[model samples]
Target chain A: MILERQLRDELKQYASSQQCPPDMHARLRQQMEQAMGKGAFRPARFRRGVMAAAISAALLLPAAAFAGNPMLADRIYGSFEQLKKKMTAVTMEQYAALAGKLSGAQAQLGEKEYARYEALLKQYVRAAYEYGNGKGYIDFDALPAEKRAEMKQLLRELQPYFDRLNGERSAKEVLSPEAFDRYIEAQMTYQTVLAQAGIEAGQRFTSQDIPAHLRDRFEKAEAVIREVSRATDPRR
Target chain B: MNEWEVQQLLKRLAAGDLAAFDRIYEMTFQDVYRTLSLLLVNRGDIEDVMNEVYVGMWLSLPRYDPGRPFRYWLHGLIVRKAQDWRRKAWRRLRLLKRANWAKGTDGWTDDSVLAAETRQEVLTLVRRLPYKLRVVIILRYYHDYTLEEMAELLQIPLGTVKSRHHHALKKLRRQLEERPQGKVASTDDLGTTTT
Candidate 1:
């Protein structure tokens, strides 16, 4: 039996004109298909474990040795030892502290320190991503304008560092140091292109920029973080 | 013909098959449009809202669960969009009423031949009644949704639907009987109070 039979015909006649335009459907379908064909993004390459160390050795140490190359071997081993020490002790808190330092001294620092500071910034980013997307409370006004600008500039400078870190992590999984380096280099260049497009870390982020529905969530997160921080620091 | 075939069609449509989408659209478009037209009086507004309704349907098709009745889900979307339109329209009308001293009227009248005059007179009489009654008459007679289905779709009690149906028809009949070309009179006038 027909449902709502009387109004049915009239309503049907009225709704018939609402068909999707043929051109629009074709365009939408084409775009979706292209996205599907592109497929999933491959996970980033990283270097770790014993296999990672072996690959690092393969990359840092030359295959052929000269008669007096014993000193060179020792130097290479020393660098590896230092690298292992650096990677093992790195923590999220350390990255945040480094970020604090980088932002404070950004204006007065030279290019070499800037590069090192940018590497520290990359470490913070990796830690943030690792720590459940680092979706904590952020105070835009609390961050000094100069610090904000420095962070924006630092995003571009930190691209190579991010690439190297991602590569090292990926390489650690499969013992491919050369592959890791290539991946890192590609990412740095890609990020450079993105920087040219003028997208920056923490840019255009303000209370006004947030959508109405999400503002409540942001406020709650901020309040929660503030409470935690206050509890930790009795002087505050 | 069977429910299984309908389910298959819906799945294919969800998979981006254009032909299935069109079939589903054709099958459901009329009722959807009528529902919208009732909520919005302007033909142009109906056309715009209708497009939004179908576009919404298309966007939501992927999320359609095969077990649910597609028509019910589609109609639910139409009702939601129509309500949204009404809310916006009510805001605009309230502003307009404040600006102008004159009162607003309802229903349509397209001057033509045959029973056009009679239908227009009756429709105008129906529109002059309380909005709740008017909605019942429009949904019941104009759209032909059953009292039970109307109650279900509108989320009102079946008894309330019956009462509204009686009240609306009673008022329409009273108005029609009092008109100049009055013929048969309805004994049940809207003089009595409803609980």
Candidate 2:
């Protein structure tokens, strides 16, 4: 009991001495005010409108529109290559912008629209994967004619929506450049630390391997990916 | 502010009074900040997490139940947020590794410098504990949470809480005994071995 008491006392003393910086409250208050002013707390009707727009845009892609075209296989391969390159080259700024737009879409989307978007994205990923394995190079001629035609139709149907979703116009419509830049910078720092740790893309590591400081930023960026995955889950 | 006062402030906040939100922030910022600091060792993260906590508070005010202790709710949010943050970080790190990008060595901040510089042996040992054990110890000792409260706050079983607390103390005791301090003795010598 003596040792336990002593340990507790020592811990209490140490915890008591720990103080938050004096300016923390002021800074937090300012941020809260800014967020409120930007309708961060308000229900996002604008987000629903954007979701509606995206859904309408997606609905316009008729699979039959490009079905059975021999040249369709080449087009699908081209589009998949373009998307892979775009995803690879996405800067922190672009990612933040994309993430912000996604969050808005998540907030506003109805059950039907969400399900549609989810199915479309899943189909797009599968098509892209089969076409090029998510890497840049794809052998268009190697695919059988019927399979090629189907892949081409899927790509033609999905590519425009993907482009609009990832494009700057969509991101800029929802996120201010300043917020996008700030989030991106934080993301860059997080990615840099992961690189230093010799962690590769899609590799798994325990939380212990992460440095204490970068964890928050790392988590924020991860939330973006998770949000996308959750929205795109076919089961959902 | 007392529980009653806090509830009143929360009521005002629910009614969209920004001043009440400010008051609540002022009242609880220290405890919230300290709790986050202990849970997350990185000083930079503490501030960001703190900002997130208040924003979360504002967004969640409409769901607040005045009957329960506000501090309890706040602590629960902080713990959940911290865990979520850690989980996300781990996932992102994995994703980066899979991409086969060159290792980014630049811009990594040294967090040891940001962690509390404690010379006290006990404090150092507590800090060195694994994150799960450390959080249990901090909640028990620093925040004065009872074993039941700790279990509830952490959403774990009561037996699990007791085991973690027992294990943490045992580890600390063993470490202290191993040190060369003459006055500090073993658990056997002190006769304070907890079951």
Candidate 3:
């Protein structure tokens, strides 16, 4: 009897100390309903390579026996193959340009600030690369209701760090010429890290390298990207 | 609705009675919401979680075993949903980093220690256990259920529930013995599934 009483008292105290404020329920229900009404949300698409592939494919593909009797099919597949080769070259060039830009930005960080900045950059790059290729990009809105809420909550917790990082990045853009040159070296170091990590250029970014603090942003972004990819992917 | 009537309404809900769904919501929203708020512990995240829990319950209603009590099933759903929330937030990782966040509160109105004066020390102690163990303790004592009933409700093996119950209670007793301040009121009227 004493044991039971002790247990109850303990349990009740736990409950009382944790009384959830009312009114939270109505808001959650509304969000859920609104999300449901919208159907599944997709993530943003950053698939330049795929988009390039599709664009070139469309431009060269009027080969059927239409009333206009366009380009013939004997050379269509060959042309697509040639386009693929050219597309690969163009993608590499674009990646180099972007990496150069990022490298230029990185060289300006002071020695003291280098560690944290490098860590954050590596984390974001890893996350972005993984998000582009893997299931990391998700549509939380389209996820099972429970999973969606869970991800959203996770995203909520991680938003502050991401906002800070973005603000810091913009602020660094105003550095003097010499400072900007050093920043480029740091950016190049980041790109090297990405390459060493086996994330190929010209593909969508992934989330594998994301640090814990920024995981929520990566998760939210991934979910949104996946939703967009699903909505836009021709194969889907 | 009373327990039996709620069961009948759930049966209708299972068979596609949208009105019955609304009835069930009215019947249990308070209970579910209150529990979710406590488990989640964040005011900002609670509402979305509550709606998700309800939506999950709605989707899973068809599979709810009729042999079990509806409240037990509902309890299971709530626990699962709370776990789901914890997982996505990676709160489990964060929990290990920080000393438990849910501790040392001195809130008004529902002042936990004051309300359960006798159990206060033990309650405070149990709050420090890991999440899974904490759930077992909460379902066992605060909500009041037998070891077997808890297992069924949580859809785990009976032996697992028994082990957790035994371990949690033993920990509580040890903690309370060390403190020895609060009184122990009879909990015979406490809500228990066995009753």
Candidate 4:
């Protein structure tokens, strides 16, 4: 009993006597504001694949639209640089917070699987850089068919990641939930267009196209709608 | 802040009010700092993790459920950030090993600063305890949380939390026993390492 009382007294006394250094509040407040202003960031260690992942994120629609800016690696790199610039307008920390969720899924994978994911990330960046960057633009469709295959395979692997992260809060601050739904809905046609590059989903995988036999797929349709709802509606 | 007031602040925070975020940080800093000080050894780490908790609090406000106690929710974030620090420390240790840390070592501390902050032998002993045991002690005695509550907050089995608490108390008791009764402990007595 004495021991307990003494321990409690020491701890309580310490807590009551100590105050956080005064600078921390102002410094942290600045950081929070800065975080709020930036786009989502992955851990610096994982920032390598992020450029490719985000570049392809705009590729969520159609490859054809992005095709033929001359398919030069330099141009692709420049365009990638531009996309990264535009992405900065949104809050990176929030984006990183969301990406952090993917780490849980990543952690669950075996070492070899994670290595493969890393490899695919590199491949996607290469293909994007080399696709259509002769001088100064991007053209995803202009890439050779085999390169397109790489993107498709990459897409197949990334589908689950995209599904997990499909609860995308648009970086655009002004987009309303209803308007947001319309935004993604407009991409359905573009999804098919990108599918033309190679995703079988691009061809006929629209929500309306679910076959009668695959009962589980109705869940996909349901989940997509719900995620969008959750994204736009702030639960706080 | 009162429950209603905190809720109002949270609402303003979620709506993008920077002043509300500052208000929330000021309201919670001391408790958060004290809790973190118990869990971490490095002051720099405490600052980093506190930044995370507050920044995370701002980012996470939308998901905060008003129905539940706000302090518990905040503590949950605090504990998780501490765990993140633990994970990062392992990574840092690995880097230190790879880089061949020559000038300084893991036991390195600036005595003028660190010793002043952790002058108490009891606190030093507690900090030196293994991470699992240390956390249980901090949560139990410092925070005055029930084992059941610790289980829920830590998302561990109740039995696991109970065992950890029991083992932590036993270890602390043993440490206390080792000191020559009622005399100040020489640095050699406590030793340089913890199990």
TM of chain B, each? 0.64, 0.76, 0.67, 0.75
Ranking by lDDT: 2, 4, 3, 1
Candidate 2 chain B superposition, TM-score: 0.76
DockQ of all candidate complexes: 0.02, 0.12, 0.09, 0.13
lDDT of 2 by residue, B1-195 (tens): 599989888888766677987899888887887777677643334655676688788888777777677777888888877765543331121122111112231111123332345555676666667767878878877777888888877779988888888788788888888877534644654322232
Estimate, for each residue in A1-236, the C-alpha lDDT of model 1 and write its tens digit. Answer: 11123233433443353443335334334433443344431111111111111111112111111122222222322332443343332232222222332233343356676557545544433332332112211122334677534533444344333223322222223324554343333332322222233222212133454456555654454343223223222122
Name the regions of candidate 2 deviating beyond 4 angstroms. Answer: A38-236, B90-117, B180-195
DockQ of 2: 0.12
Instruction: Write down the TM-score for model 4.
Output: 0.48
Tens-digit lDDT string for candidate 3 (B71-174) = 88888888887776654331111101111112211111122443376435554555455567778877766787777788888889987776776665566555
Model 2 agreement with the true structure over A1-236: per-residue lDDT tens digits: 65666667777665577687777777667666766677646321111111211221121111111112322222222342444363353233222223333343333465566456556655544544555322222334456778756644554343334424432133223345564343333333444455444343323255556777767756675555334333332233
Runs in model 3 deviating more than 4 A are: A1-3, A13-22, A28-118, A121-236, B1-4, B11-19, B37-45, B91-119, B177-195
Model 4, span A199-224: residue lDDT tens: 22101133334344432433443344
Steric overlap count per candidate = 19, 13, 37, 17
lDDT, candidate 4, B1-195, per-residue tens: 599999999998777678988888878999999888777755435665777788778767778889877877888889888876554431221111011121212223322345377555566667667778778777777888888887777778988887777666666666776967644322232211122
Is candidate 1 or 4 superior in DockQ? 4
Q: By the lDDT metric, which is better: model 3 or model 4? A: 4
